[model samples]
Target chain A: MSKEMTGAEMVIQALKDQGVDHLFGYPGGAVLPIYDALFQQNHIEHILVRHEQAALHSAEGYARSSGKVGVVLVTSGPGATNAVTGLADALMDSIPLVCISGQVATHLIGNDAFQECDTVGITRPCTKHNYLVRDINDLARILHEAFYVAQNGRPGPVVVDIPKDVQFAKGTYVGRENIEHKTYKPKLVGDNDKIQQAVEMISAAKRPIFYTGGGVINSGPAASRALRELARLTGVPVTSTLMGLGAFPAANSQWLGMLGMHGTYEANMTMHDCDVMVCIGARFDDRITGRLDAFSPGSKKIHIDIDPSSINKNVKVDLPIIGDCTKVLEALITTWKSQDRHIDRDALDAWWAQIGRWRARNSLAYRQVADVIKPQQAIERLYAATKDRDVYISTEVGQHQMWAAQFFRFEEPNRWMTSGGLGTMGYGLPAAIGAQIAHPDALCIDIAGEASIQMNIQEMATAIQFNLPVKVFILNNRYMGMVRQWQELLHGGRYSHSYSEALPDFVKLSEAYGGVGIRCEKPGDLDAAIQEMINVKRPVIFDCIVDQQENCFPMIPSGRAHNEMILGDMAIDLDAAISDEGKMLV
Target chain B: MSLAQEKTERHTLSVLVDNEPGVLARVIGLFSGRGYNIDSLTVSEVSQEGHLSRITIVTTGTPMVIEQIRNQLDRLVPVHRVRDLTVEAISLERELAMVKVRGTGEARSEALRLGEAFRARVIDATTESFVFEITGKSDKIDQFALLMQPLGLVEVSRTGTVAISRGPEAM
Candidate 1:
């Protein structure tokens, strides 16, 4: 038996049933009824944001930090259009979210009504899945299904578009237990034969490396623990992608820093020369596998992932185990123990010697100057000051982002959140806000670049309103650092519009939003500024002015193999020397 | 095969998707948005419980472009499976075409003779015209339409290629 209620009431009740305590949204004409229903209820709290786009990003920050499915509500037309970037961002990063958009009435659809657009059509590609509910009877079930699909499988964003008429109409409220999804069960346990094959390869290989990614964190804390135990038991060096940092402890001796375009020297060299590569949860993205033909050329690969299509989509593996990361890692551990798998000790010692030679390069080494603060040093000092506290870190894209990933050490899962796949610039502030909201007592900081922080600077108001102390540590270089570096290297020094002109002083900007601001321009003031920012009881912005012309290095130029990396000290000076062909390119 | 022969080949692809609203539009949008050409398209509910639909599309492209299309289709979350029926297995493909022709005297008799020869049935008829429903491979329908052009062919409407694997395996 089901009780009759208005669609708006059903929406509120469903959220309550799903254990959702908070939602981020902005009210509009189309969602007025739902907003009215929200007004009469106190069970699910709603956080009003300045813009709909910020609402979705706040939800993303909340979801990525708390490991919960974030929810948002917005109106149709521009409200829904504004969320396209966040939806695509969440989709690319596999962040689970259920975004509910209120559309125009069913009769007004396709009729060019005011405040109406093709919400379902526009969001279809961006969202993992979406629905347009036409009948009132289908409203309750669609909302429940939206959560089911968004949180299950490889997690991603899902949208449910509700019309204005449906909000006013009556519907039967069905609980979650009554809803059923057919033909959508994902395989959670891997094949036993495939696991056995992986164990055999692991026991025999001389130079073995473990490459892990965000999927381990997505699989939960158990997988992260298993990954650490496996690396210790096998005595194999481990490397990770940008999204996989917190999934394995950075302090562990077997850790080879990050592996990719901006990866450390030892990590990239090991990936290029390994005999057996065990990829646990990370896809072989282009950044990780530089030139396809030369990527891990001599390795027998083993890949474990939940998505079947992701298995052989880019790099083919000799053995494919399709299952959750924790389940598969547990099975591998069991199989190895039961078979008494062992490797040649003498061969393993030689492999470590070779790795030690690569480590001697000290790929992250940079000259520290007395006058100006280097971006790398700023992140290093920030890490040194916050290393002992319960902290969550988020970053905006560019050189500062890479430096943050290189310098900051993460020792636990789900503690670091950044825009990895899409590389969205304005991700850090709101993500910090969301993380701070989830864990009010923890120190949450966004390691941001000067230019990227301005993209979503309006979110400072949200933090101030909520009284959440999220530190925004901006590496102020006064230019789009990554773009300038690319222009210098690839465009023959004809710098485009990468420099930020007429930029407002961040100190004044923070005060304008009623928040604390601190500026540190010299190397001597760096540590004290970070400490001051951390001690502030309100929202604070720490602007650390750094070297403007410095470039991020250990970079494998586009379409080049990993071994052909250009170190920072070896980077060519574009201004001092120009080839005869450089004139033409300019 | 020679490189020239492999440059562009007509291939039939079968895609299984969730039976939900706007899914077909999403599939068709991928083709038009990317500027990829679609020669023919047919869609119908394939599951008896009414939760899944099969969309068969016939497009011509190089091997690389076809592979990209399949990968992109698979990336869509609602899409359950995508199979290149032409390359994956030996399969039978058929198209249904209704051809209308207006003729008189000897032309009319010749039209009837050709229709019988091709095993086409006259679904509608008048004294001077007949609408023949023909079902066969795409090339066969193309040949029949070409033959009817000389006998005063008026119009033609064709359902795109629908295909399935020949063996016991279900894709």
Candidate 2:
């Protein structure tokens, strides 16, 4: 059962045991031995990345899309360091990933040796767990333990730092069989008492809204359907965060849509003005709740999440029901049916009527001055163009990102992946590539902002190499939309350096990189550009030049109440309408 | 944004250690925050000062980095001294861990008595598990931890690792 081999051999065996088919990484000086062993391995296909960060992100894309453990390997120093941010991204998102780093020889370790850094020490905070392999024989088990740790419980990344000597050194490599990890089993089954209490609360509440987050997306399609059914049966409107975009269908009448700063004015107002806010698997992040004291001022919150620590970590909760989101939701449905709580049809109908009025009166607007391309209009067209397709949508953070979420009208769960918690800029393109690889048959596209798209533009090589047919929708505004909007609102129109006149020709850039590129300047041409992108059957980048001055409106600025919104060009117009929607305004 | 990465300063930090498992975790957990980055970290098991083992870690950073690292290392309950060797350049640091394995007969006995001569212990002695303990430099430990593979080296528990500055004065 044992043969003399290098630590690299043991690691490869460990990866195979963990059922890893594809991995992302690059070779370096401290990891030559690993590369040599890796060269001998035939089972795993390694993706060559332009940078180590891309390697980490590609793995993240894979994990987020497939609900599997993503793997990344890199050499010591900068290679290991570059992967940290991506590791942090995965950690924050609770995506399962295993990162392996090569180190200098054990003797040359701290002698100020070139490319020598303590990989385990550096990555500890960013990872669920890390290991520094001082012994070669421990490699197999360490790798095994790493995979187990990364995938178990509320999944996160794990790093295994293997030194050069260890990778080259001789050892008996035993392929891991029946791995035992007694310390880390998460509770999959829901507790009945809390479920019963939650059921009772839901049944009793007259005006209830579901605040859903990434947990809804991560829990899979079952959880989304469960949340929807609960909302339908209870006559409660469901509002989602950016991470929870596709958790509930936007087309569903029961769905109240996005809630927060860039969220629909009505959804935010409803969550603010509701009686009971049932938060399922969503944290009361700063984006959702502008100020906790002023947030949902009249609502009694019931927070249900798998992670116990996340229960009361943000806003105050009346009931902290801790367990799996889907499990607890199903349990609540069971308890709700048994209770047979009386329906308040008048109150439910009245809430919907008020919401409908708010949506039409104070919807996000960009002026249609004949030639101007409103971001929202572009997004609506984009959504309309891609409707009914089982495709994955990834977006860069900014005004277009918000608009995409608002307009996409997504039906399936886990189909929408964006930088929700971290709000990372260069997330979309790579994430689209990962999603495409995870589901080759399904369409994948990146709705990117101009500045954010440039951040990870190097990943275009990956798309080209694999001939991944991911369409890139670049919402070009020639400025950082989010920062520009903030400057305009808070800093009294001090635009500063937000506008960059010398913008790169995205069409030329895409062409140079061997992909189809189209420039759609007007709404009339948007369809043609989109059709051209779809026809490529390879990578395509559509540089859609949106109106530069157009901003995401109905915004509740920082340190302001949700009701105190600047709806469109007329400030406080949204507030006046929302407050006067019905007679029962608190 | 500290975009211009200042050149890493070489620092030698010495730690007086009880040499226990999970001690390393506490030492390492301090520097893994958002702003802090560690460079050139080393640990060893040098016990010239009686029962206490002194660990030396050579790291590089600006003055601010050194101070933070030292302060964090000092906070560890098991650590007695966390002197920055960058400031006090001359202090000795060495490590010792021996690898013991089980073979059929001659190889097995050779490993045993070598353990005896090195003051190593047969920590585990099942028909399969023949654990031996020896102390030396990290490289020596690593080399031995590796060399015993053909002779059945199953698992490893290293007191990873301790460091000290080179020489005459105390850190």
Candidate 3:
């Protein structure tokens, strides 16, 4: 039913109709009407953020954890401009977010009026789609369309810019059920012939590996289930991109760990030597496919993805299935079940033996010195402390993020959130807050580096005000660890401004924000400190001092092949370890 | 050999997109943002009732890059369809150019003669100048412009290129 209402009221009504229960935003002069309308409503709770960037990141975390479209509201000019980074981040990582920004009055748009900037123009490249509502009649329709566009196939951020005058103008509000998109349908089912071809390749191959990515998680729980079924049924080992961490259970015997620059030895080796590579949901990003000329040279690759653009964009595949991961995996399982002949048992056994040898390297191992806590050890202890609870983890981009990916095991999809594609440093704290808001009683933590946490430290006040028990476990290494590591290896250790000099005592900072703070310097106190941080009923910043000189290992150096990874100090000489067959394949 | 080392080839892509504000900017932005080449482009509203516009873009890339271009164009939310006219079918490519020659004597007559030889029409004329409008393949327009250069060619304005498939199918 259509009813007459002011444009601002329609904004709230449209969101309510779309089932949005929360909004992350900061108020400004231009959005007064929308704020006034919001104040009148009790259905949608607004979490006021300190910075507009935090608002967007929080929405992204909420969306990633809850598997729903995250909503954000902001005012004109800088408010919209501040959201650009998060928009770009969401676009790169395929997170679904809808941002509504107030524009200057329609007449004053080009007059350089107060608090005015071209929101749609600036966000065009970063967002999946955007709209600027000139007429009040288009307001409700565009709001509903923004939500639809954000959460659909190959989901990404969408922006709707509403002029202040348009917000005040009276218009007829149309519910979502009355609106229909004519040209935005995405393909969800794969072609049967191509799926059959994929199944045939899987059954005939010996050294087969499934390289999964965020698409499996994005496809929802059903896709993860289908993936587990397919892996078990075909006896194929599985490795994932950092974004795909929890889609396949970490505890499963067939899991080969994450595959990329900082991936495990066995995972990267399997990617290089596998005869049949079934890549589902993950685009072969540059990080994943090192030295593209030498990547998986001998493999018959099959790529399954929902976006047609993702296929053949990086690594070309023999079979390209354009469909949702869940649908395609289901088809593969059914087709493989019907085939009388399966994988060659003898060749499979030999392949498993080679993988076992690679696993024996223990690429993730790092010596724990008695005097100090290694970052990896800190993450392992944190994982141990919270693994039994209803937990969601987010991370800032740094060495700590890598350690969390390597050591903190995820058993379910959506339990881990990080800025994978853009690698934004300030993503974690706000994201943890967003996740905490989504699942009120769940244990939410931001695995952060000291340098990365400082980027969005102001959000601690927001967490305290909202009563979110989000924990920020800071691995205090006193350096921009990733940059320091790179400088040491590639730039002759210049260090150049990589040090975290003039750092705030995170404990005091947390206390200043009216929250609890815990500091642990000794390795022996790590577990108890993590437990204390977890048990805190309010926002807490756990400052865990770790080894300052540690470097993330098992790294495929930039421009190097996947097979040419530099393992940790404990690893044996890899050149002598590779078999003659592996040498020939390389 | 790596796919990147392969020789690049020119391809013409016809894209149907929603005829709305900033839609063209979105299409152009994709090319510039991704570092993809755009040799020439022409766009206009094709269906008034359907609110659709057709954009014809000429780009040069390797086979893989060309495939990437098609897929990326198709991925745009406003884009309805993307058809590679160069490879999909026997297609016709044409461009419209208006050439102005500013000579009073033989150069003006020569420019007019060449324009007629290329099926050009005299759209405008003055005592000291003549403007000839011509429509043909992009190469034909290029050749006509080249010939007019020596004939005191003052200026030339050209619509880049527009193409259509030869078959009865609709893109």
Candidate 4:
């Protein structure tokens, strides 16, 4: 049915039709009309965030946790500029986001009027697509199209900049049914010939590995199921990127933890030595493939990704399959079963034995301190307390993020949300808020660092305002631990400015923000404190003081090949000889 | 790129993009941000009904660098298609330039003589000065302009290169 409505009303109506239940936003003069329209409606719940950046990150959290296209509303100028970081983050990670920002009136856009800036100009490179809606009649269509483009092929963030004048004008409200475009249809099915080639490579391999990535999770739960099934049927060891962690069951015997800069010994070795590598849904980023020339030097690679540009852009593959991960996996399984092909059990057993020897290195080993808690120990306790429950994990960047990825075992997709590509600091708190809002009854926690957590600490107000029982687990290590670690190893131990001197007390800060706080300094009290934070039906910031000098290891120094990795088992003596180049102490 | 084959080659690329604000900026930003040199650039709306604009860029780079530029341009969302006219073997390229010559006596008469040889028409004339309008390939205009430079050439304004493939198929 056609209905005449104001531009603001049309936006709300379009969002309603598109099944957007929650919106994260911060109001300003340019977006006042949209806020007014929101005030009159009860169908869509509006979440007022403390900052525009937090709104986008929180929406990201909500999107990443629930597999929904997150929505955001902000005013023009600073409001839009504040969102640039989050937009870049979403773009690099392929997170689906629709950000609607209000611009100055159309007549005053060219003039230096109040809060007027070229928002579309600033955001063009950072967004998947963007629009500047001039006519009121086009507003509804543009809004719906924004949602479609954000959630469609190789999903990423899309922006719609609406001038204030359009918000006051009247327009016809056309829903999603009437807002289709002919130019942007993305192909979903992989080419059959290429799928056959990949299946053949998989069936004939000896040292085979399934190197999965975030694309599997983004392809939805079916892709993850297909991946587990493929691993079971093929008896292939699976190694995931940091973003691809939960796509394969972490608890499964075939799982090789994560493979990257700080990844486990077995995982990195497996990647280096695999003969037939099936890489699903992950880009070969520099972080994943350190010193690309020496990466998987002998592997016959099969890369399956939805985006065609990502194929052969970084590392060329023997066979590139462009399709959704779910559909491609289904095709591979069908072909493998129909051909009645099986991997030679003797050669596979040899590969498994080689992997077992690598796993025995215990690269993650660290000496325990009796008085102070180690960051790794903190994550271990956090996992032990929450392993049996339904939990969603989010993280800020640095050493703590690596610890969380290493220590926390995620058996399901869409349960772990972190800023992987951009590695934006202060992403965890607001993301946790968004996750908590989406799954209110589930346990959502932001595993954070003392230095990184302060970046978006203001979002604590939003959690209290909404009464979200989100837990903030801070591994308080006094320094920007990652930066300090690098400086110590790479720069002759000149700490520079990596330390935060006048840090605020988290217990006091949490109380000031009208939430509960707990500080666990001793290793013995870690589990009980975690239990308390979980049981408290309000936002709790658990400040677990940790060892400051500890560094994240399994380190491949910058520009070094993957095979030249330094394990942490003899880390203490290596730390003592700061300038020694790969000298052994064992 | 190898040290033995490091010589740069000039290539012209024709790109079709959405006709909207900031689309041009995005294209130029890609070039400038990557430190690639643009020798000549021109843009205009080619299809009003389709709301599509065409941009022609002349750049010099190695084969590997040229391929990188093409791949990066292809990655832009609003860019519908990009065709390398240099790589297509058969294509037509043209540019128009208006050259003004300020002189009296023999210099002015010599300018007219050169204009006739180059097929440049005298679009505007005075007793002491004349403006000649010439249209041809960029190299032809460059040669004609060089001849006019000694013949009392004052100022020259030239539209950048515009090209099209020599076939019925439209890009």
Candidate 5:
């Protein structure tokens, strides 16, 4: 049934077998043969991007929402290099991606010919696995292995670098009978002993809080409910990392917001206040614990992450569980027999009561006395408009990004995708295009910063070309808000060039790109703009120009403790202002 | 204006093929089937060559699918060796692309000044872009292309990249 074909043809055919619809990439020398072969295939559509970075992020967007492997193509040398950041981001966040790059002919490799680089070596650290195809016949197997590696183990990026000569070589397109992984295997089943120990720790603790991260999303809705049931049954408060926002209902009574710099004041404080912090899926990045020494000093840490390296990388853990969250939770629950009065009696209730007091007495306020629209309020409004619908929300980096992470909660897993670790700029727009392709029925949005959105504004053409429905809500503050906010607070307000003097009229730009453009300059026009975007069912860019001076508050300055927070409206010193606790932090 | 002005391009590649069952046999079968000539061929397992060896190959093609090889190789099984000798412009792509120009007369003198400004050179200059061998990044080649465009975009050749892990590391 299978005959001779080039590695290029086989790869394309394999992608076709997988039912891939759209691919994003740009061209170069070493990869010419593949392109030539690819020209004959019409089943898959390839979107040409301005930069390689955009290609990877776009693929990530496609994969995160669809639970499929997003594929990208780029030429050798610089093209492969540009995709590294996006690959690292996907690897850390566990998004499925398959990236392919061309190479110089194999003979002149180390001699450094026209467009050659050791791509497999370069991407090894970032990718779950990488394959360099010398033998054209092995092309089908390599792709199959790459996809299997990317989608199976914790879901990450995989690279397949083919040489120009190899691509043109005649190869047989015998499909991979099945995937066989050797090096990287993410364990989905937990050990009985470890599971029992985790449960015992949970049951014995006086004050316990479930601290989670993006891993919960990969666990899907079923496991999430299981974790929530465990929390509900035990009456423990729950919190999340920035990536873990939608893992649980944001409005639940025991919910204690996200934990990090710009984390909810109570969540960050709770991490410190609790006697036991059961961290799940999140590696305690520096942003989460500003000063590790002061981070949960009084707490006994139980760090549970699928990654063995992350087990004790950031925050030291007394009890470490290394495996997939769903598997681990299932094992723990199986070993855990339901108990009635196993609660630490008054100790647990008192902890919960204190968190309640923090909310009742000092509800982390971001409201302005003069009625200026707060970023949090904007997020709240977006969430209210969507109404727990299955929507894909992609965000650009900085303050607006943090705010969206802080609020605008979703219910489904893989519904939210952002550049979590690498913070690649110009990620939002292209990613939205990819997301729209994966989830045509659900609303797809890019919550963008003015600076970050411009990074991939050209992708508007890709959206228009495909007639994909992608709504872009530009949180236009006319500044690099996150960097600017840091300058305002930590650097004594010494202004930098974060101010953009030649900011484009985004609405006009969107219109120029063959999409509907909606501008919301005031709160009154917000709903109409959102409605217009939803109704269009095509790409729409909404320029929501907000106050230029606002900052994302409840910030834990770098190298500071959770308790040391600079709340919003810090121009008026909280020391001089009345404190509900009747004590000044200063 | 002239066909000669377009210059010539050469490419080298290293392929990582799987040394398993009939994987390499099938891949070699593909190459011979298509009648594509490989300039050079080298195979050794960078990671357990007995089980998974890499095959380094060299061949030349027009700009058309210089981008397609790796895309194709990535689809192969056991074929682990496929890296572009030229993948700089996209990754840290630049600071890795070297400019080689040839020149003479006013063209050569002007090329030197311009190359110096862009931090380029006369690594081998007879009379063109000075064979102005400027090695820095992929962007440098683009800048060199522009500068040479006026000074005579003459004959240009570039070595894609010989990049390694940034830290004291190897990949």
Candidate 6:
């Protein structure tokens, strides 16, 4: 059945039909009609954000935590342009989002009229798909399709550009059930032959490792369960990328920590020495692969991913299976159970012994001083204080983000959110606010750096306005720690513009936003400060002053192989660290 | 195998995609953005009712790079199928070119002589100039244009290469 309604009303109805309960956006002239219609409806709550970029990042956080497609609405021109970075971030990290931007009237699109821009054209490369609603009759259909496209296989952001006239025009509303997509169907199940082959490889190999990534989390909780079952059935050790940290339980004896730059010594060593590498749901990104020529040179790799393009993009594989992670893992488990063959126990023991020796190095070790707070120690204390609570963690891109990933142990999926691919600096604060809105009772915290947190400091107002108790834990080192570390090691310690010269007092700033603030300068005061920040019933900014000269360790310097990482205790000669080959890579 | 050991080769890929606005731009943008080389490209609508368009692209890359291109093209939402005509099957390739020569005396006759030898049709003619239309493989077109250079070749406009497999079944 179809009913005649204005386009703005249809937009609301379509979102309702799609089960969207919250939308993050800011109002402007081009989107006034949609805003007016939004005001008339109470089913969907509008989250007014200070900046469009914050709006996008907040939706990303909401989507990452809740396993739902996040929604955003904004006006034309600058509004659409401001959302580009977030869209690119979502695209790289495979977050599902649907961003709706209002454009000028259809007749005024190309005439340089007020607030007119080519939204679809600008977002084409960043979005999974995009559409311009030239006719009001197509608005409802496009809105539903945008949601469908955003949440489907290898999900990414989608954009729907609606002109002002189309939002006000009267048109027939089309229900989602009436629409049939002809060209968009993703495969869900793996081929039986490939599953059998994978089982044979796993059962015969003496040394094997399961390398996982964010796709397992994106595949939902069932996939993570399947992963655990498969690991138990095969008695194989597992490791993950930075984005895949929570997919496997960190407390499991068979689990190796994250494997890449700044990863654990055991994880990277096993990745290099494994005979058969079972890569499930992870792309071999440049950061993960290190030097492509030397990456897992002896491994006969088997890759399972929903996106076929991810397989063999950077590292070649012996077998490739295209299917959803859960469905494919279920098939692999069934196949492995049916096979009667067993792995060589003696060789597996030898492999584990070698891995134990690497773990003995304690690659994440950092000396704790009596007066100053170490960043790693701060993260450890924060984790210990919140380990038993229902918590979600997000982080900005820098040394502090790496420390959070290393120290925060997650037993389940969807509890940790960070910018893994694009490495955006200001992603954590808004993302935390978004996650807080999704899970109102859960403790949502943004582990931030002094330099990174300032990138989106305006989001403090959004948190206070919504009465969100999200906490921003800043490891204040008074420098862009990652950049400074690289400068010291690779650029003769030039340190050009790497220091935070004129930083604001975050505690005062938080107080100014009608929120609580806590500052801890000594190691002895850290735990109480974190507790105070957590107990506050509103947004709080906890500034923990840390060692300024510290650097993230166990790092595979640029163009270096996995086995050639520099541990925390190892003394580094700057000249030797910056090799000619390292200079060739970014 | 390491990247340095692989030999670089040219491959022709045929892509079937939705015949919609910005589809061509998406294809072209992907090439430029990824730093992939596009030697030649041709696109035309193949099915009006189905709203399908076929694009033929000639690119040069290592074996791994070529595979990457095919996988990347297949990942596009609007794309239906991607076939590397050079390796998938026995294929035929062709292109069309229109060459104009501006010469009055012996050079004009010489241009006409060479055009006839290449089986080129004189589509437009004047007392001082002649426009010849020719169709053949890309290499053959290149050879013809090279021969026309000494014959006062004023201008040449050539369609990029288009290719199809030699089989009873459709791709």
Best-to-worst ranking by DockQ: 3, 6, 4, 1, 2, 5
The better candidate by lDDT, 2 or 3, is: 3
Give DockQ for candidates 1 onward, in order.
Answer: 0.28, 0.04, 0.79, 0.31, 0.01, 0.70
The chain A TM-scores for the candidates, taken one by one, are 0.97, 0.93, 0.97, 0.97, 0.92, 0.99
lDDT of each residue in A130-187, candidate 6, tens digit only? 9989999989888988898898889899999999999999999989998866677788
Compared with the true structure, what per-residue lDDT tens digits does model 1 show for residues A391-498? 999999999999999999999988898999999899899888878888899999999998999988999999999888989999999899999987887777667999
Preferred candidate (lDDT higher): 2 or 5: 2
How do the residues A1-586 of candidate 2 rate in per-residue lDDT, one tens digit apiece?
Answer: 5678778777787788789988888889987877787799799877777778878877877888787788888999999999888888887887889999999889987787999887776786677777788888778877887887787656788888888889888888766675665334566667777777777777777777888887877776788889887877788888888877788887888777788877788888888888888888887887788755688888888988776556555466788886777888888787777778644888878878888887776566667756877888888887877786778888878887888887788887778877776677888888888788788888899999888888889889888988788888988989998778766655566888877567789989888999888889877777777777777788888899888888787677666668866677784433234332221311
> Retained native contacts per candidate, as fractions?
0.16, 0.06, 0.75, 0.16, 0.00, 0.62
Worst 10 residues of 5 chain A by lDDT: A577-586
TM-score of chain B of 3: 0.96
lDDT of 5 by residue, A1-586 (tens): 4778777888788888767787889888878877887788788888877788888888988887776789999999998998888888887788888898998888877787776777876776677667778888778878877777777646788888888888888877766565465544555676677777777788888878899888877766666877777777778888888777777787678888877888887887788788888887788887787766778888888777666556655456888887788778766666665433365778888887788776563435766433455566667778778865668899998888888887777655677888877777787887887888777788899999888988888888878887888888888888899878766654566668888669888888888998988887767666766777778887898888787888787777666777777676467653333333222111
The local lDDT score (0 to 100) that residue A384 gets in candidate 2 is 77
Full ranking by lDDT: 3, 6, 4, 1, 2, 5
The window of 10 residues in a row where model 3 chain A has the poorest summed lDDT is A577-586
Residues A1-586 of candidate 4 have per-residue lDDT tens digits of 5699999998899889989999999999999999999999999999989999999999999998888999999999999999999999999889999999999999998898989899988898789888999999889888988998898778899999999999999978887898786456666899989988988898889999998999998899999999998889899999999998899998999998998889988998899999999999999887788766788899999999888767776676899898899999998888888887788899999999999999888878887989989999999999999999999999999999999999999999999999999999999999999999999999999999998889999999999999999999999989999989877876678899999799999999999999999999999899899999999999999999999998897876665567767887653544444334332210
lDDT of 5: 0.73
* Pairs in clash, predicted candidate 3: none
Which model is ahead, 3 or 6, in terms of TM-score? Answer: 6
Q: What are the runs in model 4 whose C-alpha is more than 4 Å off?
A: A571-586, B1-11, B34-37, B60-72, B86-89, B100-122, B125-132, B142-155
What lDDT score is found at residue A228 in candidate 5? 79
Candidate 5, superposed: residue stretches over 4 Å from native: A1-3, A17-19, A338-341, A361-363, A369-372, A569-586, B1-171
TM-score of 4: 0.93
How far in Å is the alpha carbon of B81 misplaced in model 2? 28
Output the better candidate (1/3) by DockQ.
Answer: 3
- Number of the top DockQ candidate: 3
